[model samples]
Target: MTKPTLIFLILFSLNFASISALSQKPKALVLPIRQDVGTNLLVADIYGRTPLKPVGFVVDLTTRHLWVNCETNYKSSTLTQPKCKSAQCQKAGTKYCHTCPIAARPFCHANTCGYYLENPVTHQNTVGELAEDVIAFSSTNGFNPGPLVQIRDFLFTCSPSALVELKLPKGVQGVAGLAHAPIAVQNVLASKLGLKPIFTMCIPSGNSNGVIFFGSDGPYSLLPGLDFSKTLKYTPLTISPFDEYYINVKGIKINQKPVPGLNISLLSVKDTGSGGGTTINTLLPYTILEGSIFKAITSFFAQQLSKVPTVKPIAPFGLCYESKYFSSTLLGPGVPSIDLELEGKDAVWSIFGLNSMVEAHPGVLCLAFVNGGNEYRAKVNIGVYQIKDVPLKFDLSKSVLGFGGPLSGARTHCENFNFTTVA
Candidate 1:
């Protein structure tokens, strides 16, 4: 989406309450965010009393935990143990799953009080002391960059264990939680800088090229230039079953026919791990839908593939056939948009056939969804694969998410679209 004609103004010297409109700036420190092997990460160097090395910090919206690499290279003179006296210490006492007890041991032991989180997948431990550090977003552009933002005394766990990733190129040094929790990186920054508690990001497909902005007000309410308010859709954030950002999914329909039993309710999503709001995660490689929804979607696929000669089935991915007919199957294939009914009949999020398929091998693509087995409550995981190239903005202040695309034919610099208040 292109920026509108209105202007965004930033008053650096003004108090948080004062920077209401005009984009509330000293201009948002726009930074580049890239996808590294399914993980959305940014470069965030951690520096203590003595400077430590700066490295890539993965941004995870699903969980609220701040962690830094506990590599041996981190030997700063100022690393201090977290004091049990403060509430911050209680939260960072240990890895989230460890369930560190509330007693004295929870916050401190052997004069070392910080945190320890074991990698659930790797079973390795990341141990560190709760300490303060600096968080900065490395600039992507060669020029027209804003001043470096280094938030000092930033509280986080400094674990020494290497992040265990099944895939390599091992670019992540730590994780900065952006899940809107009390201790999240974004929340801490908003509170400290007195800026709006909101951020917007566009994850570009393929290239590690993407951008992020921080603000609370809507783009339309702020500046006309590069405003999303035009096509931006709104839905109330779902709060129960999990505190993560979720919109009420009223129904799922294909060819305008609503599928029964596919919904977002406390009972339906209680076990979905559906990062569908929690328990369900968006970063997963494939989308997992409730069995009923899965059946509905696949039924449509069967009709479309009838005359087309497709390749054989692939593992994990639900469908695969000869790719020779791929291009034909996608074009005018009578495949209708999969509409996600949200809030009211007027609100619909459409997922076309191209959006639901993933290329698996040479000249072949497959359906990237599965029946989220009985283990999960009825939930839907909006995997990254389905959202690539989509421009979305999460208004932390409003708890509303807006996404735009038919996959713009021309590249839209939505992330680079920032405004400065008139001098």
Candidate 2:
């Protein structure tokens, strides 16, 4: 071959090799999550800024956008505001222009994409500028983490410092929205990376850290050779107009016995848009049931555990028992299991002692569920405490929620994700 031909062949080989290496790299993103001891909320550490500083964001299940306070001492060289008419602003479903009385700064800019952001804790609303910045995350191949990858133009919002309420835990600068909205971090990752619209979360119950995996369907490998994905049971996942996730719970049972006096109709979403239905939330620490359902379940639960010595009820907890009377098992205090029957056959999510019982005081153990006041929208609101230790796979494209039964049943837990190993 001539010199030019040889040179062309060499260049082609180098180009092919570069493309092959890029393809082999993981397409998934992983974030290490830890439960906030003070608020009982979940928080994920995200890498931001040039030197890669870890920013704490409280994970919000229903928040529409990931927003951070940029009022004071907030600095990011990569931060850029999307123009009012830009595609990013349109994708965010907002065309309003943000204005500020204060001089121009990070959040105070002219003709910027404006968005209405809310504080999940205090329910306070504020209009903020929709901005983009370079954000980094650890790449994973389902089994182990790969190199740290950067998203050059990540979409998010910058709000005033006042929106950061006291209800949020200390050191947490913002709220990471994981809802179905376009601007949500998960949806943004899916659209920008061309990966599957799926994310898995393992919320740890104790002090140990948990994890969130975005953009990959996985064999959610935990310790001791266990893969959470293999054991998952899926149910139809619905979304409300506000982008909140809802699961169809057909019925409830205690120890294989149907919970009596339950108005099963209330479990279905109403067409009138008034009330009724069941939804899940990470913000709520304990599950809350409607008035009638609460009464029925609490009465039955108390009757089932009649043999266990009863103690005076603690505030917010209707029933309490002497902690010493119950024996501890792998799941928790030995008690009858509660089950939420889903849409499909044998589609039951069971709650063992670990999630069913809560220690109210030094020697008092109470039911982990709460009584949603006399009038409430959703009949049953499943909370973090009830779903703790379970692996959740949310498939946005398919509109399905996969639940991996309590990890303790398999002698593993959410904290088992091997974060120490980097691919």
Candidate 3:
């Protein structure tokens, strides 16, 4: 017999796929995220109906599958994986296991259907069985009493093990997948909530809390009047082979002069598996530049510090100088500006320097661009830190991505949701 969880998954998917309710005026929800331990992750409550203590999940755009910490940690006791020989198991038989390259999954020794996920950057693995349950985001920035949005019969995995070296008690437990795939929590919730297939992320800066807004340009957004989406720079949004977002880079300019090093082939298959691999990820802790581009920027930094005494390099960071001796503004107000090639001149998304400098220690600021390895799959990322105080709008209806410039001074984070302010 089919497991009840698998049955619910099949029924729930079938019900929503052909629903008669047409896409109405888009509804929007803005949920604030947590910046735990330098990683910009969305920490939200799971399973609103259950009385279980809340656990936090990382809302990473590169994660392709929804999963929880452990089976015992799972709030819903009824959550179960389809047994071997079941249709869900049969489906798993066709898909490749990245970890066990020799065989496909449901290579079950135990009767449970299972899979393992491996993250390339952190080299961590989350192993578990597929299951179903409900997921909910708390209303007020994960601090208040009630759930803002709750969806029942949600399909996800229950993982009991993870090889996490950086795990902390006030840190990530599970990953909330947001890749543009069937299993992505963002896509699933967008469909169920009657919202647009779009969202926006803003970090503002190093001090403030960030928020993710769903349906940025639809009827739900305050674009024309109160919102800053209208004023953001624009570019033609492209998709990777693996269903992640990509943007075109026409060229990079250093102090208004074109830097020829950025013009190179950066083609790489991103989001190749169930884990993080997107080229430009908001949640990625560091910004990565293609090798040649990284060299160009560091060399520019070197010339600026030629007069200063020898500065020791920080591990992982190729360039670092004591900020007390050197001006924190060595890269200056406008050093490296990336010119993104959009269809028209008006749509270009120019880059800035405030996003590139990293403060590693007391009175120390380093150019934070990591050298993306020589592999064809390596990607250049505009991480959450690089886009500080800027708003990135993913407008599905227009198939365009908007990137706003930094706000004047340190802008305070926006609070409260206004459902009545329909556009």
TM-score (C-alpha) between model 3 and the true structure: 0.71
Residue 370 in candidate 1, Cα distance off native in Å: 2.9
Alpha carbon lDDT of residue 374, candidate 2?
50
Per-residue lDDT tens digits of candidate 3, residues 22-86?
Answer: 23332555554445554454444343324323456666766666766653344555445566566
- Where model 1 places Cα greater than 4 Å from the true spot, the runs are 1-27, 38-53, 75-81, 90-128, 138-144, 162-169, 216-230, 240-243, 260-280, 304-306, 326-335, 409-423
Report every candidate's CA lDDT. 0.52, 0.81, 0.52
The TM-scores, one per candidate, come to 0.73, 0.92, 0.71
Which candidate number would show the highest lDDT if scored against the true structure?
Answer: 2
- What's the residue-level lDDT of 415 in candidate 3? 27
Per-residue CA lDDT of model 2 for 1-423, tens digit only, reads: 223223323333333323224554357877777778888988876767654466779998889878988776677888889888999999999968876567655467888888998898798887888888877666777666566666778999998888885689887889999988998989888877787889899988877777789988786788777888888899888888778888888988997899999999988755314667888888999998898899999898887888877889897878889889989998899999999999865679999989999999998899988888755567888899998998889999899999878899889988777766555
lDDT score for residue 334 of model 1: 30
Cα-based RMSD of candidate 2: 8.6
Prediction 1 TM-score vs. true? 0.73
